[model samples]
Target: MEMLIVVAIIAILIAIAIPTFASSLNKARIATDEANIRAGYADVMVNVLLDDNYDAENGNASTAGQTKYYLQKDGSVATTDTNAYKTQGKNDSATTEIAGQKVGAWAKDKKVTYQYDNTKNQAVISFE
Candidate 1:
């Protein structure tokens, strides 16, 4: 029957659309994480400029004299917690690692990772 054929075609169309929609959603989350990393880098630079003796090893920019700066969603300086953006690896290495806790829903247990180079002051974002 024509009705049965039409229903089958509609179902196929929906199946195709579902995957595309999910892919787009995942890409959006990745983009958001990238933006957050860039913002954190900028905040750190600002703190470095403000405090002449800011010590990056202390990891407490808001407390004065610390070189490292943590960023919040509202763009305020965070003194303690860096849960939103987790820093990994060593700054002295060729690549310092940064990670975002909340990844795309489709990524399941995987977290988004970024490799930062202090020499060039650049970050390379990745999902893993």
Candidate 2:
């Protein structure tokens, strides 16, 4: 009888722990995604500053007078299209590539979107 009670308590503890662990993991992923978006925006801004005629509307492509930016798995920048960004989260349906580089993985329920505001000369990253 005593052994049965102990087993039941252990089972209850396991059930409680599993969901908490899952939640924490999800939070971590969200934080990472936010950081990636911020970093990518910053890199684009730097490129704009360096070029005298950086046109946000046409700067992301590889054509003449346009700059090429490559997104990697960790959300870092690369000069070439070697390691494009791949989705790492629940939303595998969303496109991981933005402009020319890999953005971070977005969650299915909380989708992430990016756009270049030509009038403001800024990159906007938002979650919806």
Task: Tell me the tens digit of each residue's lDDT in model 2 across 13-113.
Answer: 99999999987876666556656666766776665556655545654422212444554556665556455554344534345554445554455444333
Tens digits of per-residue lDDT for model 1 on 61-99? 343332333445554445444444542211222233344
Clash number for each model: 1, 3
Instruction: Report how far residue 107 has shifted in candidate 1, in Å.
Output: 6.9
Q: What TM-score does prediction 1 earn?
A: 0.54
The global Cα lDDT (0 to 1) of model 1 is: 0.48
Worst 10 residues of 2 by lDDT: 59-68
